[model samples]
Each structure stands twice: as structure tokens, then as C-alpha cells.
Target: MSAFGAWTTAHGLPAFSYTMDQERDPRAEWDPILEPPTRRHAVHLGNRRITLVADNYGLSGLFDEHTALRWLTRDTGVTRVGELSTDISGSERIFGPTFVIVRVADDQVSLERTVLCPEGEAPWVLIRLRVRNLLGEPARLTLTEEWAARPAQVNLISGTAPSTGPDEDVGLELELIGGARPRRTGSGRLAVPLLLAAHGERVVELRYGLLDDTAPSFEGSLAALRDRLPRASAPRAPEAEREIPWHAALLTGAACADGVLGGHTLDQGSCYSFRHGFNGAARDPLQHALPLVYIEPDLALSVLRNTCAWGSPDGDLPYALGPDKQPWTDLFRPSDQNLWALWLAAEYLSATGEEAAFREPVPYHPLHRAAPVPLGEHLRRQFRFFTDVVGRGEHGHVRMLNADWNDMAITESGVDRELMIAQGESVLNSAMAAWVLPRYAVLAERLGDLVTAAEARKLGEELRGLVAEEWNGRWFRRAYGPGAVVGDSDMWLEVQPWAILCGATPPGRAAELLRRIEATAAAGSPLGARLRWPVREHHGPGGVGTIWYAINMTLIWAAADHVPELGWQWWRRMSLAAHANAYPDVWEGTLSGPDAYLAPETDRPGRTWDLADLGIAMQAYPVANLHSHSQPLLAYLRLLGVEPFSERAGTGDGARFASRALTVGP
Candidate 1:
């Protein structure tokens, strides 16, 4: 049994086990796993198992190991997995009244199935499905099935068959042998039978193979073939996470939709750190702060520190990292660049509470005697850039304030300006540096250089002063600020409170900002977070808007620090947004033309990394953990309730502000 396993044992859920029979290769030439999802829609065409939601109302678009691989290809959004079909002879599928179908108006679906092999290995799959409901409701009811075969090396799943070779044994059958059942014979491959409530569904699952290996190097895979599914069948894993390597977060509420997600893994540690910024550029520093936000604190903090080191002797950082450790992009947004870096590092250290760890040398850029990343030099240069340079002409921040990308604001718009300075301004950077400079100064003091500590104190005070002076515009900006105010980012402040919560704003302004934020929150569209006071238009880059995914991440931090009870509020809003938006999965932007709004389409480049990071970022929420949160849920709730570092966000000085409301735009 696995450590988590225990039926008769202490720590186990009701245990049901299974074993499979030996099978002949149908064809060495044919791949087994069928269609893989181009994006994380219910559509599947790769080597992944899937499961479906019972209520069709929640997470109907989400995918799990049981979502039929065949259905994924059909371009359909189905609530439940159908029983395996018997007549897949031609292109047509088996249909029925109880089944769900994609609408004809939304004919993006084509009933299809395929066999896929993952990296040419042991676990293979075969799936058959049709998309009749993805674009809209369907004309006829239809469902697909998939057969997935995997040969796992570790068998991390307890109560599952041990890793005996495929040739060595036929599949193992788990029997609900004795005890209570009126005498009856359950035959064929052995298994557990779960009685479903009328019109209700339950997750049927099994994890096999962990009984054997412990090494990461172990190689084993699944092999599968499509058979007309069994009687009254459930579905495949129906979840995308079963196939993609992801960490998940969780949310719980009755009104909540089926899928909830916190974030996705962009790099190993970063979550939501843009893989590429404006003009498709990416920053390496985010890997430490964003990716590792919820997973590994020590490693994440290390990434943040190293990123800070990249600040040049003149105090600039490489725009992005190349494969060769060279800077990739040249355009840097000081708001996103410096401030985010500082916040992330301090966030990590604050999270761990192991101040002692701060004394050590960070990775890649260091020599124990004297690391070259001299803070004094870099800080001075950065100070000059923000206070002195950057710009003031036609496209300057002071001029454009609400402008898109680097153009600044000319158009009146929504939730981005206070957001801009709050993210970039001197105070945020100072606040972050405040934490570090002092620590480093303390280290210097301990090392007998009290003078450095004194200097550090000055820097800290300066940074704090900057915060009080700027980075404060409350509520969701109705537009940009005073001098450089863009008529567009009409100054309201839904996003302003986050600045206060994140420490970009001064503590005194928090209550006012919080109150403004609460009033600005949109209540009508479950999916749309109002861009401003009146809530007229949508706000975002890819055109789809940023509220849905962005809020999932930020809210978790909200719950993590000030209010765990608020998690339900976050989930309700996001869940409703997903449905109000009605996307099979998220889109790069909202759709206005001939296509479905950013919903996943065949061969489309997707926001995979974002989804992964959402899961990681959710760790602050204290609702779900790394293992429990996955798509479509975790992507929507980056603040998984339970996490590795709840110690900080959950009960720190920040906790004092939980009940307080923040008013930013006064």
C-alpha cells in the first residue's frame, strides 16, 4: 500500500485495486494514445486519460485523464464521458438521447479518433470522439471513448499492481470479494463497482505501479486500444493535467463551476511570469519569483536573488534570457522590470521566514568573498533612471500614463495605470529593496561594518518615503492619474488595493483602497471583473481581457494574507467568469470576429505556461495544495488554500490588514 493508502490501514481512502492482463501489440506501426488537446479544452488527441464532470454545469470545458481523447478532437464541450462505443467502423459515431453533442452552428468539431504514442514509449493510447457541442449546444447527443495503456516505472500509486513487466502478467483485477454483497459473481477483469446516484456521478479512479520503483530515471509507459466502451461507461481521465506535468490548487464552494485553477508552470518556479512581455519578450528573473511562488520557496528565493544580481553595474537588468545566458530583449518596462523583481525576492524571503538563508551567496553570479552584484552601485543607477531618465516627450509615462504597451495613455480606459506605477514606481522598488538592504546591512553589521548597515537604513527610509509619495491611486482607476493622466485608464481603482496588499502602497492607505476595490468589483457578469467604476468595457492586451486569469492569481494572495474566508469570493467570481465567458479553455483575447472568443482551436499556440503557474501561485490561498489543484479548477484559483508557505501570507504582519479596506483614488 502507498503511504496515503489505507482501506483497512490508518491513512487510506476506501481502497480499490486493479491489475491488467497481458496484451499483444495491435500493431507496432500504430500509435496508441489518440488525439491530444492543442490547448486544454475537453478535446483530446494525444496520449492522455480523461474524466468528465457529472453536472455539465461546472467545468464542462475542463479536461481530466478521463475526458475521452476522441471527444477532444471533435471540438466539443461535454459534461460527461459516454460509455465506450461499439460501432466506430465508419466516420459516424454511436448516438443516443442521454449523450451530449456539439451544436452545428459551432461545427468546429469533427468526429475523429486516433492512436498516439508518447515519445515512442510503453504507455500508448487510442481514442474515438466527436465534437458536436464545443462551439455551442449540439443537435444530437453523442459521446466518445478512449483506451489508455501505461507502463509506469515508479508505481507511485499504492494498492495498484506492482511493476511486473507487461509480458510477465495479464492485467490485475480488483474484486469487491466478500463482506456485504448478496451472493453474486463479478467476473472478467476484477474491479470495484461504485453505485452512482440517479443522474449523479462520482470519480472512478486507480493509480498503479508505484509498488516497484523509486528512482526518477525509471521508464515505463501505458499502452491502449479503443474498444466500443463498456456498459453505462464513465469517461477517460477527462482532465488535461493527467498528461501535462502540472501542480494544482483547489477551491471549494457550492455555486463554483466545475473547473478552478490557480496557475501553470511557465518555468520550474514561475507562475504567470509572462513567458514573453510586450513584443513577445520574456524575463528570466520571473522564474524565481513567479514560477516558484507556491512550489519551492528556497529555490524561488534563489531565482529572485540571482535575478537582482543581473542588474548591471549601471543598474539595468537583461531584458530576457537567451539559451546562452545572454540578454534576449532590449526593451524593458521599469514598472514590470525592477519592481516585480524586488517584490518577488522579498516575497520569497518573507514567505520562508528563514532570515538566516539570506546570508548565503545566490546562484550563477557569485564568489563567496565578494559577489560582483554590488547593491550600492546598482541601486544608485536605478535611482537615476526612475527619478531622472526614462522619458517625458510624446510617449513618456507622464504623458501616456494609460498608454498600451510603451506608448503611454492617450485613450481613456481601465484598471492599468495605478497598476502601472504601483508595479513600477520608486516606492515598490524601494519597499522590496527596503527588505533586502536592511538584511544585507545587518549581515554587513554582523560582519563588523556598522557603516554599511547605517547606509542600508537610509536606503530603506528613502524607499519607504517613495511609497508614501507615490504608487497610490485607489479603487479600479476610472482613468490614469493627475499630471500624466490618460483619459482612457479613467481613474478608478479595482486593482489599486493589490498594490497596498502587496506593499507597493503605504500601509495607511490600505483601508481606503480596499473599500474602493470592493465597490468597484462587478457583480453582474460572473466572469467579467469590471474594468472601472461603471464597468462599461473589457480590459486586456490579447483583447480578451485580463480579469479572469489575473484575478485568480491576485485573489489567492489576498486570502493568503488578510482573509482566508475571501477565497470563496475569488472562486465565485472566477468560476462565473469562465462560464459567462463560456470558453472551452482560455483564449489569448476575447473574440469579436468570425471565430469563437479565445477558445482553444486545433493547432493553436496556447497559454499552457499560464495555466501551470496559476496552480503554483494559488499556494498562498490556503485552500488547495500542489497535488489537489489542477485544471480546469487550479488554473482559475492560483491561490490554492493549502500550500508549502502559508506560514508567511497566512499569519504575518500583513494579517493585520485583512479586515481593513483600502481606498486608493482619493
Candidate 2:
């Protein structure tokens, strides 16, 4: 790209887009119109109609601020803007009823409220207009009072209590334990005939103190007395002269960490990809996968444990799992999910020393990083699901089922096991075997269970041998599905040859995969290529690629560990390749492309967890070598190293170069 293009990339500015709705509508059903400036012109509100814009994007739907992915990753630093400031009462508990904050990148919103009568000295509640423009257009759109909230709050689900079924009045995720009749504050929406547009922000806000409390239930202490959280402050470039380095570091870290999670989870995980053609936006797991990696180690371990528990006595993670918990195969494939998550888990465990954290239990609360106490047995079982059952490799060669990351639905019936393997293509289960066996071996030995340790090592060796034998030498097969065999070299498959089973791949094959990756045939990208074959299958709306930042990071790390000589080059290549998500929280995957779409998990019912693990991908950057893969990596790569990446190249080097450019007191 050009210097201007490079600048646009580093700063989260859009490079190119189809400006008109007509051009946009033909391709995607649910195209993500992220910039308030770009989409506001297309939206119109009818009387009494509030079409939630954020809901379409995997958020939890509590206030505009609540998101599905972040809920699970709550403990991680990636979170809502409201979290950064005080609520109305100046307390964490009290937040606005009118609007809610999502990621910190969304620091402010432009609220449109109609000034009301009885406007005394206090005039009910003081309206705060929060403006945020994702387009990098330098200005806040100020919406005069058009609506207000007595106790402002975006509509969000509360508590995971048993649902009495879907009711229009109550949120599915939220629960009002005791008699809780939320007050009626006559909160109104801003009139729409007067459609106004800021260069970049859509007017959204919250309200409070405009009316009297209608109900005495649900404890005012928990609801009314909680101090209001301060609104997320807008960072003015001029005023932020000193904070640039800090913010830049944080923003870059968020992006790199998320890159490690490429193609991991099925829910929101499916939404990540880098295909720039037809299947450009095909849903996969990587998007939020890695962010979750860094944010919560225990959570990542739980996911691994689940994968391990699923191993069919013979060892194989299944194709996929329905939100309802049914097994799915034939749709999306989990080739990398099981393995990647497992490797990430083991690697994370080693770094964080979160064994005690894992003993705590399941339901794998994405929101909380370290559970206070051990989780119950039932929860543990859930965690062990992937570790213990799904694929046993029973009838055939420790075969695996063919299901994509989401594993929710692919419409398969009377399915048996598949027996196809290809090189440069470390299938999901195989990847799992490589990542888990070593750790399990160490763990089993520590517990003094000789048999268990032996079995673990046996499993690891068995997988390593199988991968070397099955992979078609150059590339790996897509799946062990019906008759079709996708034999092509994919970049994602490149990592296992190195990162897994203590580098089981032979020197020649390892070099081949690295070369393919560097050449961009396997993992091509303006930023980075995706492992997606049949780019013809690029998913959803637009004509964008499936590249995900998290996946790129994983490949780079694996290369650093295995290829060594070539690792730094790929490292430099990838370091300059991340121009996707503009939320300050890395690209969920190349965002500008028409392909980016919501993952199946985001479409699932009830509350959901965001992919905070992706936030940790950056932790591996500055390693002198691959001494520590998780925390220590994070410390050196993201926080410790000199500039953390491409140290020899120095500052002001490339377009994507995340320059600290500052000296901080912290």
C-alpha cells in the first residue's frame, strides 16, 4: 500500500467501502456497518420502534454496551466503557438505563434526547452526549436532548436463572431474584424525522432521575443507590499528546492477542476468517479465540479440558457441538479448534501456572478469569466433554468427525468416523493430541500415576506419527468427511509441524510449510492470508478475505519455535500485517471485506462470552526465543521487550509497526 494507506491502516481508518446501501445490500444479509457515519444515513426509526443496532454484532444486548463475547471474558481487560468510569451515583453498580458501553474503544456515544418540561434547576437528569466515530473522523457528534433516562441502562439480560420461557417484557439472561419490578421512567427515544449525522458517530445515550421510583422491589441499594459510573472519556489527540504511547501499546496488544485465537470457537469463533473472495467472511473460530487466550488462562484450560474429555477413549474431538449440546459433523470443521485450543491451553497453563485455577470447575464462565473456588463435578464433566468423549478413533485410525468450529449444525445423519489425513494440514484432533499429551504427561507424572503418564505420552506419539504419515506431504486434507477430500496446503496447518509434540515434523517438511507461509500461497494476506481453501466458499455478505489476526499470530509463534531461521521473517511479515478490527480491540478478522459476518455462537440463545483470549496473542512477540509461550511470553512480547517486536528494525519502520514512541512512568 501507499504511505497514506499505511497511515490509514495503523490508525483504524477505513481504506475503501461501498458508500451506498444499494451496493451493500446485494451481498450480505447481516453486513456489519460499524461506522456510525457510514450507516446512520441508512437507518430510519418509526414511532415507538427501537431497532437495536449492537445486538446484531454478538453483544449481550444489555444496554448498547453489553456484548455476548465480552460477557464470558469479563475478567479480562477487554471490556465495556462503562467499566472504565463511574455510574450515575459514582459507583460501579449504577449505570445508565438509556445506553450501555461495549468495548473501551467505544469510549463515547452521541445521545439524542428531547428536552422535557418541568425543567427546573436540576431539570430532571442532566443529559450527557457521548459521541464516538469509528471512521477516524476527528469530531464528536453532539445530539441535543431528545430523550432521557430516569435510571439509564441499555436493555441487557441478567442472571443465568432458569427461564420461564421467552417473555417480551423480561430479558432472557437477566433474573430478578426477589420481587423486582423495575421502575417506569418514561424513557423515550430521540425523534427520527430530524435525522442528523456526525462525520462518524450515531447518537446513542442513557437517562436517569427524570421520574419517581415506581416499585420498591429489587432493592434500591443494589439498583437505586449504586453510584453512577462515569461515561467513557473521549481521547482528544491534542489533549492526549502524552497518552499516545500507552493507548497505542494497549490497542496493539488487543489486536495481536486476538490473532492467536483464529478459528477456535464455533459460536463467535466461526466468524473469524481471512478469505477475500466468495467465502471471504466464512465463519470460523479464530476471531475471538486468542483474545480469550490472553484474558483468561483458566477459561482457555477449561476449553482444553473439554476437548480432552471429548476424546473417544481412542482419542478424537468430535466435529462440533450444538448449543443444545448435540454432536454435529458435516457442516463446519473443527480441524484446528481442538488442537489449537489444546495447545493454547497447555501453553497457557505452563506460563500462568493456573493448575489450581483449572481445578476450580466448569460452565467455563467466560466472564470470570479465576473462579473463587472449585467448580462442582457436573461443571467439571462439562469441562471434560472435549477431553474425554467425542472422538475415540475406535473403528479406524483414531479418526475424527468432520464438523466446523461452531459444530452447531451441518445436517449430518447416521455418521461414522472419517480416516483422511494430509500434511501441512494438522487436523484439529491431531493438533489437540500434540498440545495435550505433553502437558497431561507432566501432570500425570506429578500425580505419580505411571500408567496415566505412559498413556498420555503414547497418545502424543501416536498422533505425531499419524500426522506425519497421513498428511499428503505438501498440504493437509480438509476433513475426514463423506467422499470429498480437500487436499491443499493451508497456512494454519503450518504451525502444528512445529508447535506440537515437541516439533515432530521433519526438517524438510517444516521448511516447506514455512516457505509456503512466507510465500503467501497458504496464508496470503494484505495483512495476512487465511488457511481457508476454496476461497470460492468465502462466507456471508461482502467480497473480503477470511484472514484473522489471531490466526496469523499463532502461525508466527509456531514458526518462531519450529522454523527458527525463517521465524523472524514471518514474524516481521505478520507484525506488519494486522489491519482488521477498528474497535481498538484487534480486527475480529479483516473487517473491511464484505465477508466478515457474525459467528454462529453469537447467534446462540442466552448470554454469551466474548473472545478475550485473542487479547493475549501479543504476549508471545518479544521472546528471545520460545522460552515461555504464554504469560512470560506476554510479559516479554507485549510488555517487556524493547518495542516488543522487530527490535532490530527499530521505530518508525513499517505501516503496521506499533511504535511505543514514548517514555512512560508506569
What is the lDDT of every predicted structure here?
0.28, 0.29
lDDT of 1 by residue, 374-444 (tens): 33333334433433443222212221222322212223333355654332222223334444455444444
**Over the full model, what C-alpha lDDT does candidate 2 score relative to the true structure?**
0.29
Model 2: how far residue 164 lies from native, Å: 23
TM-score of each: 0.42, 0.46
Best by TM-score: 2
Q: Could you give candidate 2's per-residue lDDT for residues 27-75 as a string of tens digits? A: 2222122111111111000000111111112121111111112211111
- Model 1, runs deviating above 4 Å: 1-294, 305-311, 322-325, 351-483, 486-489, 492-495, 502-516, 528-533, 536-545, 548-567, 571-666
Q: How far is candidate 2 from the true structure (C-alpha RMSD, Å)?
A: 15.0
lDDT measured at residue 93 in model 1 versus the true structure, 0 to 100: 20
Return the top candidate by lDDT. Answer: 2
